[model samples]
Target chain A: MNRRLLLVSNSTLYGGGYLQHCQQNISDFFGKQVKRILFVPYALHDWDQYTKTARDKLNSLGYEVDSVHEAADPVKAVRKAEAIFIGGGNTFRLLKALYDNNLVTEIRKRVLQDGVPYMGSSAGTNVATVSINTTNDMPIIYPPSFSAIGLVPFNINPHYLDHDPNSRHMGETREQRITQYHEELNTPCVLGLREGSLLLVEGNTATLLGTTNARLFQRGKQTSEHEPGTDLSFLLTDAQ
Target chain B: MNRRLLLVSNSTLYGGGYLQHCQQNISDFFGKQVKRILFVPYALHDWDQYTKTARDKLNSLGYEVDSVHEAADPVKAVRKAEAIFIGGGNTFRLLKALYDNNLVTEIRKRVLQDGVPYMGSSAGTNVATVSINTTNDMPIIYPPSFSAIGLVPFNINPHYLDHDPNSRHMGETREQRITQYHEELNTPCVLGLREGSLLLVEGNTATLLGTTNARLFQRGKQTSEHEPGTDLSFLLTDAQ
Candidate 1:
């Protein structure tokens, strides 16, 4: 499998500037091999503002960023691009836009078969999984389907937070919701990636990168945490 | 327009017994008119356990409760039932089961036309709206569509909570998610009913019952709070 993917939990850390914390990782991932990047701003409500913000940030790193929406043919733009960057917003809207524009298969082919470097944050990272069933976003719009680009073997629960023991809120916690998900569909493992954490995949090797630990959830088993620098490439295998 | 519905935010309050707070309201709503109640336990992982729990609760209120699953013909049972109750669990599973059983139209006919009293807590309340797009539950399964029974003109967001001012979590708040839903589909108004809050609708009159304030969300407008005892019957009209 010729895959190079950077799946970030969030674009910005709490109280931090946009994409500021992951600038070094983004630079290292792209390097000199990637120059002009195709930006997918479909996840956001305001694509123009989102594209401008992303353009400004990536321009600071000496990379040219162009939004795919501006292209005459989105499929052509995706195929011709050296790299792809999907900014985070509402996952439902993002997936719907991808389906509406008929870009799911095109982007998947470019990333998996052509080895086009792919980077996504929050909702963007969500569509790289088997399904968006574990997404935290509200069902704002009815996408054609919950099926997403299978860039990774497992589902990603971005911006995953721990349950607050002292809180009085009666809603199901993130863990409870994921547990319910497992109860219903038990095969695919859920990766609860917290803010400031990301998964960097190069070929068959997938590395957990961040200062904090990422929680891994499996059916009928206790959840375990993994620290940064851990080799999680085994998750790429189907035998899990 | 001979509608009679009870849409509750949650089955139970925080640290409270199951369906304890709303027992009186339940009794008053059903009274002597509805003798046998059909319980929909599809939302729960353990249908048998949920049915048993609901039977015990409703039994104490002087009503004969039976689960729709145990019936030889589910649709016939729904038609023959004097009243219907839907328990809280995952909204996706509940909606999927309803669609699988082909009970969406049956339940709607009973509640909207036949004057069969309808009661739903959490996920159940979610299905009473035009669509399940505003639900707070995880999308564990994809239903046939986001469309629901349309017993109400708008949408219901059960177990709605306010954002914590001091929290450091980067995930979107309940209000933020609902606002995003409004951004994508602007027509429908979403009622954010807090725990212990419920909307009781009889014919054309819908009253807010309970001690808390329920938040109302409209597209491109400020979200306002409505206290219990307020007349919310205008929500039933299509002019909104």
Candidate 2:
């Protein structure tokens, strides 16, 4: 379990530039060992534009980036990639592309077995979990399955939001939606990672990184909040 | 095409009691023709409790409600049903039950061919569309497919909400999610039916019935808002 993963809740904060908030952490995680990275931009509809934007951001941080879509063989590209980065858009679309290209297993093998550094934001971070059941995105497209890379034990609910007491809207709050998921699946713990929050994993150790606290939900248990810098390595070994 | 349908955005309003706000509309739509109503409580986790609650509400309104779950043969029950009501809960669970019971075609045949009156709120309204692609509920469980009843030509996004200008959340807005859906599916129109709003359809005519304006989205066009009482019958003839 020498996997290195950086799962960010969001690529950009409100009123912030693209990937501006997590640029330093991205550089620190990959470090100088990783020079070239393969980018998975399938979650977005406009693949060229998404890849260009991500490539520019990574290039500014002294790393060369190439999109997997440009490769003649996606599976082969994943096997030979130095590091992997998956951008955020729609989770269903992202997973569909991964399955469509038969790159799901290859990427998992590289990241988990080969110990390749992996990074994802939003939809990208979503697939790093056991399943995409807790994602906030719409089912814009149907993926082959909801099962993801299973890089982590518990499910991750990225861009987690607290309910506004004054809202007049009748839609279910984020908490209620997650509770419904637990009703169907009582085993996997759901980690509600708010914007600006991320989970950094190395081997069996998982650490909460960001300014705000991350909320945790498990069946028949009270939701507990953990502050930044808290050691969450125990979650890595918890039941799926 | 003699079909009768009442698609409600939500069962409850912001500050109103459960099913209280739409009681008059429900009665006026059914009138004296409907006496015994077949209730589909499959969307709810607690079918017995949900059926009881709905039965109490309908009984107060001079209608006898019997849950489809109590029927020895669910498909046959749909064939002889005078009227049908599908309550709101998780859309995924509702669609799964419909598929598992092989009632999707039966209910559609009853409503479309037999002219049986049909009513649904939230998830129920969602399943009335060609597909449940625009629902606001979480996908706690996966159905056989995203394909739905297709009682209507287009899709329904119930509990549709407007973006909060003051919020800092990075999650995509409801409008954005629907827009992404259009990117994949360009034919079907999407109606964002807000709370306290509903659509009433009889034969080929569909009318907006509520106090608030409903939003409409079509591919290659700006989202348009239509006020209550507007004729939306054209939507019933559009592509699925």
Candidate 3:
């Protein structure tokens, strides 16, 4: 498969502006070859507002954004786009809109077949993987299916947090949830990306980018941690 | 509909033993007439261990425990139960098992029509509501439907936490997630049950119980805080 994806953990980092944490990486990944990017803001309730936010942020980074919500033919828009960016909100709502609008196959074709640069933040990062099962967002709406675009072979848990030893909350920790996910489907390893972390996939090679470390959970193996700049291409080496 | 439910936010609280926080209520709700309680440990991965834990805990409270997993005909076990207690674990796994075993209708009938007392904690509480859309558990496995046993007319978000003003995490807060749920289906309200909190329902009247307050999110209504003794019967007044 020919795929180029810049999957980010979050759109905004604490104490930073929107997309500020990964602005440089976004610019470098798209490069000078791409000008206008198609934005998919269906994860949120207000598509226009979400598009404006992405537009303003990307504009500051030297790119133009054409929102899919504004297009008369969304499928055609995906085909003509130079690159694609999906903003984050509720994962279930995002996947539902993708299926409802029939953009799942179109977006996948543009990324894998055409090799259009694809960027996603949080919920967007979730849909790029095998499925949205690992998302931290609420299932506010019922999507037709949990299956996603499958741009990568593994599942990504964005905005992943470590267990807080000092906290008194009784809910399962991120690690425990991922462990439960492994219990259901042992293959297709789960990768936990902390805020400010990202995975940049170019063809078959994927590298961990940004300032934080990523946690990897696989069946029958101890949870492992990899730092930024680590080669994660092994994740994309085989299809699950 | 004649329904009696004790939907608890969590089975175990911090610094407490299993079901320790809600043991007194469990005893009071079941009363002297209900001696043997049927335990549904399907929410967890280890049914045997979960049953043993519930049996030991309920035995200490002067009630005999019978787990449904041990029964050859689970639906028959639910039909013959004096009282039903569902322990907490992964909500998706619990709902999937319920569908796979064809227990959703049986459990609902036993609780609503037969007037058998139903007790639940965390994931168990989630399944008693209108749908599992408000649950905090991951979608490790997909159920046939997001629809759950409508023991109550509303949805539940267990282990609900308030936004920490000082925290830097950018993920949506419990309140925001419930708000998104409202965006999807605003009619059936989403109730956020903080740890150590539970809802006690007898007939058509439901009251908030436990040490902490519960947050109620309804469509087009401001989020309201209800004290432990607050009468929440309005939530169950009408069918959604």
RMSD to the true structure for each prediction, in A, is: 1.1, 1.2, 1.2
**How many steric overlaps does candidate 3 have?**
0
lDDT of 1: 0.91
Candidate 3 structure quality by residue, lDDT tens digits, A53-169: 999999988899999999999988998999999999999999999999999999999999999999999999999999999999887788999999999988999999998899999
lDDT by residue for model 2 over B175-199, one digit each (tens)?
A: 9999999998455899999999999
Q: Which portions of model 1 show Cα errors greater than 4 Å?
A: none
Against the native chain B, each candidate's TM-score is 0.98, 0.98, 0.97
Interface RMSD of each: 1.0, 0.9, 0.7
State the weakest 10-residue window (summed lDDT) of model 3 chain A. A179-188
* Model 2 regions more than 4 Å off: none
> A1-240 in candidate 2: lDDT tens per residue?
879999999999998988999888998999998999999999999999999999999999999998999999999889899999999999999999999999888888998999999999999999999889888888878888989998998899999999989988878899999888888845599999999999999999999998889999988789999998999998988662
Q: Can you give the TM-score per candidate against the true fold?
A: 0.98, 0.98, 0.98
Where does candidate 1 chain A have its weakest 10-residue lDDT segment? A179-188
Which 10 successive residues of model 3 chain B have the least lDDT summed?
B179-188
